[model samples]
Target: MNEIDILKKIASNLTERKSTAALSNYEVLCNNIAFSHDLFEKGIVYLEFIIDHLKSIFNDRLSLKGDFRENECLHPFISVIPSLLLNDLEVIKKLSAYTPPDNRHGITIDNVSLLHRGFMNYNNLATATRQLIDSLVTDSYQLQLLDPKEFNYHVLLSLNSFEKYATKSIRQGLFNQEIEDALLEFRKLNFKDWKNSSITKCQHITFSNKVDHLFTNLNLVASEDIKFKNEINNLFKFSSEFTHIGYISTFFTSQAGSQVVFGSEKSPYLPSTENFSELKYQILETCINFIHKVYLPSLSSCVSKIFSSSQELVIEKHISNLVSLLKEGIKTRNNSYYFFVCSSLIGSQRIIDLPCLCGHLNKWRPPHSNSDLFCTGCGSSYNILAIEGDPGYIITGNGPVKVIGSEAPDFQDLPKEKQQEMLIKVAEFNANGSGN
Candidate 1:
């Protein structure tokens, strides 16, 4: 039948159920397409920022592996984002970001194999998922359009198979020997009797469930986006049975269920937190989760070598912000969480310029020795050592000025009485502005 005949048949079928004409299942699916791009764009902004942050820190230190540059951490992110073409995804660089050291280096916190393993897992999963999505859009759409009279149900079968494939790979990716060995044994049987097995009793879990499992294993957790969770669960159920459509004449007429609504009722003109696609959000979050579990902690490990309470707090807060951003999206941006690095983590030494009058600064010589101090603001030099007994007070044109500088070794080694005598002399110099 032509398009008009198809519409008439849909209308006739809906009328029989006493329902108004509604979007077919495929229409609902198509309407949700915008969810993918908008959400992925926002997600990429954060991912790029994160990659840049890692590059700024570890890129210089990583070793080049083959043609893959040591510092290039964008491979995984690029692998996921929408691609024009990706035929060779299987052979793509998945471990380039994880080059090992040249020598037999002991695996310290700074060089944890798990950290690199996290990146490799992330890259590999994204590669597989991207390829599957490409097939979903290209092959699935083509198969569906071959003829309305005979759309391929096998495409939907492949879709079901691919989701389960991803779910299984994710389970294996955990790298837990116990879990791996158990899953390995199960796979050997082709999961023929998996339903009777102790581990899950044959129930298939959604992506969010796998993520939760990962977090539980790692002793870290993130809040789930309920809508995202539901969408993924629902998506897997879209075509659960391979023989479903063969028995239903309504399959072509109702792509999704009849009661389902497509798109949103909200006005587009208003500024709102962009709604991300469930698939895109999870994919993006997977990348962020890897960073959270491995990259940030590795950075923290390197940073903690130096003892600084403020720096530690700052870095921890930074890590927390990143996790929140990934889970909550731009909602976490209100507090400037997107910054790659914060100044507080730098723990820089603060210096007061000492207000030079002629824009000139030079080390002043004391009669006793060269203090290597540069505190003179006026044309005449002041006896700064007078403040050793009291760094809290310095005599000057502005009366008493408190000056604290890094300890002057020469002055620190002097006798207390001598220092006091010098203080008295400085007091006299302040009183006359000429007596040293």
Candidate 2:
């Protein structure tokens, strides 16, 4: 069934069971749904702000010069946010499907399964949120400091993780010899110094030697207090448990009601009402904080850093204006105006590479949707077909000049130096176009 239908079914059944446990699940379910929707809506708002700002800064830089060097750095991180947001949505859906194991009969097994799924979804949601925060910070570094040592460290950790897991699977007979040999060959160069060490050596180095580096890289890596290290450790520890053992342990334990169902003593176990409620509320709070405190602020910083190179003061002014509008909107209850102003301020400029006459690349999302064009900065709309035309005019000394498509230029028509410069610009634009 669809998510809406499932939500409706839960709501209808909530009233049927007035027992304390059943009532608590209903309340928690309602809260979970509400919290998820709030994040989803806010994510939409933040995403619009982020993408529009990226486009604006890109086009603004494009207008001043033919070569925009920073575009490549912005693409990878900007492309990461939407998928993370999608992960949040999926977690929300699972939370909505979960029901308390109050009726320990025909529905008990399904409810238990749903609860386990919710835990797994929450783990994924948390991971994605953390990664999004990290990516934004990396984006900021690319713009301001241009240091990539930490970025490469993350890359090494990721590759090492894959190698470690692949080797483990091979040992467990989960991968054939050919696959094992391929993985070993891929790791050969990386393993030169630590030839006898386990493949997880990089992972160990990241956690043990790079804690300070991580904190320095991103404010969200840990809490901004004395207990930051503890918080980071705890977060990773809990996430690991949730990912590997928590779901399976749920079936074997009788201590609490938080979504486990396996046991030899299987006399239809369920967590205590209080314990179950606690777990549910904890997940809700984490999701909300991740969105409000971690994700949005880091994303804003990333955008500001990328655009601040040429017009730092102007970027700050626009952000201040957006904050003021948001406060006023909250006071006057004009959410539409607030969001519009936010979009206008952030997306004041359009992407240099997109093909819309308004010169704005508006709302290109929901991958399957054919109708993803609606400009908030300018009251103009276009379809995917519009992408074929020239990008909007750029401010030039002579006046605003329309940008000719990069393809319009013949490479050999220019001096050798200019030709090389043109090739670099085209390559940068293509990288930005891919945005990943």
Candidate 3:
């Protein structure tokens, strides 16, 4: 049977089971399907069931008003809506278009206000979904799936649907032209270039810049509370760094081979496939958590702060929420020892030059180098040894030197005099005839 049919059967069977094991399996199956394809309505049904099943897990009775109020509910609900089938799209589109003021059919203003707050909660889901889609499509280094052509086709199809819904809901289009242009450009993108490109760079910069503008606008509206302005600015700066530069730098370092900056006066090395994959997963999780737990909450609270009266309780609540989110984010960062472990694993790939280090030029060298010369390719010095009665010199090294990879120091950027001076230093060092 197709995935949908199977999910339907599982959902049907779930209603018949009273056992916790069966319910847990149903939840896992639902989550897995939700993770893969958001279009699955059956997955949604299953999730609703899971929520009801787990209702007792919550404490405060007021907090148990609905499945949506729980923070944990946000991730799963957001996950399932995007890949949902076209027929099911209307339900999600309706959810997105929900506005509180209209909900009471022109009744009391208090009811309208309550509905508006309800809409905000739903809007958070939409924003979360958009963020998740962006994350999945633009992984670290901005690489799409191994097959860009296939991924772009899917993205284009989704963009068309997105535009239609956006136009209908917003009463005006925002991303229609931008989405079309991006799709067109995507078609022409070279896979290699896309792989190397920093997908987060432009988006991160835009978001960071937007935060600055947001603060500026807020400062104009906010009362002349210097302390409040300062706090908001600090929060903006922290969010900008967390989203843009800090996370990107961590991801780039994890992916772009090792560095010589830490521990044991040794050079950095390329990471193993497993090590790189693990780090990549950790970085991805960190980014996802930051967006969900930190960025979204901060933006939502800031919006409320900007619009609502400056009641001390409301202000304190928002500020406390921001602080709590940041603390959680900080705690998630891996310890220094983890970084050292990753670096040590990376260092094992260092290159060791042989013959050139021993003052012998007659020995055969690797194809990238000639004779017993120092190999610029791998950043290692070799030596050539003329063993008694040997037909030719043997090439060897005192120890393995770390490979510098493609981003080694650029000699071409240096002035000619400086370049010559560096070469002279290298020559003198080699003439001294010591591996040390």
Please give each candidate's TM-score.
Answer: 0.25, 0.40, 0.20
Question: Number of backbone collisions per candidate, in order?
Answer: 2, 7, 17
Model 3 whole-model lDDT (C-alpha atoms)? 0.32
Q: Can you write out model 2's per-residue Cα lDDT over 1-436, one digit (the tens) per residue?
A: 9999987875555434322233343333333444343333333333344344445555454322222244564344334434444544454344434422223234345555433333444455445434433343333333333233443444444555765656554556655566456456546645454422333223224342333433454454544532554444455455556456554345323222344343211223333433454544454444343334333444445445444345544444444333332222222221121011112222234432333322233444323143444555445453332223343332211111234333334323445454333333322332233210
Ten-residue stretch with the least lDDT total in model 2: 334-343
Ranking by lDDT: 2, 1, 3
- Native-referenced Cα lDDT, model 2: 0.39
* TM-score, predicted candidate 2 vs. hidden true structure: 0.40
lDDT (tens digit, per residue) of candidate 1 on 388-430: 2324334332112334443333432555454434433333343
Model 1 gets an lDDT of 0.33
- Candidate 1: list runs displaced more than 4 Å: 1-18, 21-40, 52-59, 62-209, 218-232, 239-322, 326-436
Which candidate has the top score in TM-score?
2
Lowest lDDT 10-residue stretch of candidate 1: 267-276
Q: Using TM-score as the measure, what is the rank order of every candidate, best first?
A: 2, 1, 3
Q: Which model is ahead, 1 or 3, in terms of TM-score? A: 1
